[model samples]
Target: MTERAIVAGVPVDTRHWIGGRRVASPGTFTTTSPVTRTALAEMSRGTALEAEAAVAAARAAFPGWAATGRAERARILHAVADGVEQRLEDLAAVETHDNGALLRSHRRGVMPRVAHNFRFFAEWLLTLGRDDFATRGHTNHISWDPAGPCVLITPWNAPLMLASWKIAPALAAGNTVVLKPAEWSPLTASLLADIAAGAGVPPGVLNVVQGYGEDLGRALVSHPGVRRISFTGSVPTARRIAAAAAPNLTPLSLELGGKSPLLVFADADLGLAADLAVEQYDNAGQVCLAATRLLVEESVAGEFTRLFTERAERLRPGDPREPGTDLGPVVDARQLERIDGFVRRALAAGARAVIGGGPGTGDSGTGESGLHYRPTLLTDVAQESEIVQEEVFGPVLTLQTFTTEEEAVGLANGTRFGLAATLVTGDRARAARVAAQLVAGTVWVNCFFVRDLRAPFGGSRDSGTGREGGGWSFDFHCDVKNTVTAPKGWRDHG
Candidate 1:
């Protein structure tokens, strides 16, 4: 199991990693590459039995792991980071091959962040502060205790990176983990288990189970032994998980879907604004935090639209493995059809497609037909239209004009989602004013997608529940306890 077998010319090791060993499932499922529209690998299709085993293993390992010294945990986490860095190129390649995102992005942006997730949390654990104070003649000491076994369910869009975001914090807080990566992309998650073992993580400390959400995911979240659950996926799935875990009353953190907006004012730099708008097309618009809804001031709408359309059309779509490819195919044919359906319905509803409006062929000619969708920009859509109100989750952008500042804010906040938003303006007062009013968990003024690992990251309303990053992450993974003691001489006096 140490070496991967070649499937369709891609190296793949498909097995469940449980109790620090590779466990074979009763059945297997094939995962397809969006770029080639062909079978990429045969993955272990986990059942409830596998899920139960993973949970048991995590539970068995929890006590020793939780009791491990902070310094030793930090050292082990650092070693994990070192292991990730050593396989940076290989991991990036496998991620791109499995998920169809641009290889350059995985190599330069995503993979580096994966390593940093481990390293940053490792350092944060040693320096993490707890409150200690005296009040009412009593001294109180606050400490965070590990919350037992944790189950982390990650999405397919950025499998390894996002998984680490949850994994690092859980491990840093001294909790054992059972990771269930999205079925569409499980190769990297499997590889990560190997990486963890190589870095000296003890058996049963970290386990990975690959399968659909209905069976494996349900079992993992509903299991009574699971003390904490963190899931990143669609709203419907989150609701289901919540219902499943309700009986057990297991603490849950859910990061769901978003239809984020980007606001552009007349005073904003047109060039920078346009650049930010086009960034929504990155990852083929699979990003949960992408600003798919563009709200522009009427005075600058025409100018901004022209700039955005020009840059978007110039983007190169090709094989993700190519260094020059700016955009890759959507995850699969099903996803491609979903994107097309959204655009078609919008068009029929009288919205105009200013640029690309349908399926596109890859420039590399290596992929199957209908795998690529052109970067699309829509205009003249009503405020209440489905295109504007829903999360397309594709390379599609909808533009709406706002007559006044109040109207702009209304349009931006109209949707049920409140994941993230971007405000483009030169006036510092207006930027601060509008940013404060935006109903999103994360708001960027004069920038987009700029992330600081220590900053809080999550959504509001339908976007998600709870937050993660820095102390917030620790808050979710650990139980904060307050120890109170009476004044030293009070008992003597009594």
Candidate 2:
């Protein structure tokens, strides 16, 4: 299949990619661009029929894919990487149009990471090792066997990149996949299925089904043939998926919601700290790992708040495709309303909006009205308020002050989310101490959102379950088996 150049005006092909072919569905749902508020594509709304077909296809292909040598698998994955590199710009445009993330971000970082996900996992698989030891005159060889079929449900925010995070590792570990992308941003996943096929990934090795989460997602997760599931979304949906997979006892890797905190110490570089704090507004704060809760030392609260609010007010929310756009609209109108509701409630409760407190108009001349929410900063908020505890998942930041290190740690760990946190401090000992006390799975010191990809990445508490990176990814996607054998001398004697 020839790849199409996806742009704002061009219509996209959003069909189900099953068994390396474009499969049609009985109904279709329109996907609108958050930039223009116009229809960009009609996604095939998958049903039980499509779900059953996808699972059956994956089951039939799993044995052959698992039996294939690691070297050959790596080769095909490298080819997939090559395909991604060749179409990076096109993929970036599609994703920007579908999800309202900045096109520059996709081209510069996100798209390259998508290709790297495949290449990195491929190389990691080659150097992967298992346990081999002898005990009590007997030898035990531990091997990793690929789980059968995997169901990957990715979120609309950073759609293709997050999906690749799971798909690359799952495929490298030798599992067949049935990917059900978020209905709002299904175009890039379909494009990826084509890329995989053209790169010689076998039929049914990577299948994509598009539709709503309740119907299509439920069907995929609850399917009897699915052996593993990896989902990136909200906590409530993760719970629902957990309940659905309970019957089959299928293993799940869920990366859910987060109300992560950014701790700024008085001794830290206020300039750099303010820069990092404003970065929470990146992708319009749609990122799950963003440090949305700003906890500042009481002594520096005024200075930090001024710096942060100034930087935030300068952020430009416009058409994602424009090169000058600093931020883009929230995914849709529903998300816009949700973000506004939180800000409105906080204001009614006496929380002060330092800069933005409501929805943004189309005054930027690039995005539609009601879709863009201004980068917001709130101060004088109670520590236990909804704006502080809940995962707003928007360009909204709440500032609070703490007097002591213990109070800072307590406030940072107060939320139910343990996905990630950021600490900005000049003191090495203090940085280490605060980071150790942080309950998050990943903690950033003196920076924000710098990922190694080889370290474990996930959350705790209500944030998520399981981790994925390097060997951790394989651990979730494969079953470790131990085979025991008698010693050579003992076998001879027998």
Q: What is the C-alpha lDDT of each candidate?
A: 0.90, 0.90
lDDT of 1 at 429: 96
Q: What are the models' TM-scores? A: 0.97, 0.97
Q: Which regions of candidate 1 fall more than 4 Å away from where they truly are?
A: 1-4, 7-11, 362-369, 489-494
Q: What tens-digit string does per-residue lDDT give for candidate 2 at 287-361?
A: 999999999999999999889878887887788888888988899999999999999999999999889888887
Task: State the lDDT of candidate 1 residue by residue for 156-195, as single tens digits.
Answer: 9999999999999999999999999999988889878888
Q: Which ten residues in a row are the worst by lDDT in model 1? A: 1-10
Q: What TM-score does candidate 2 reach? A: 0.97
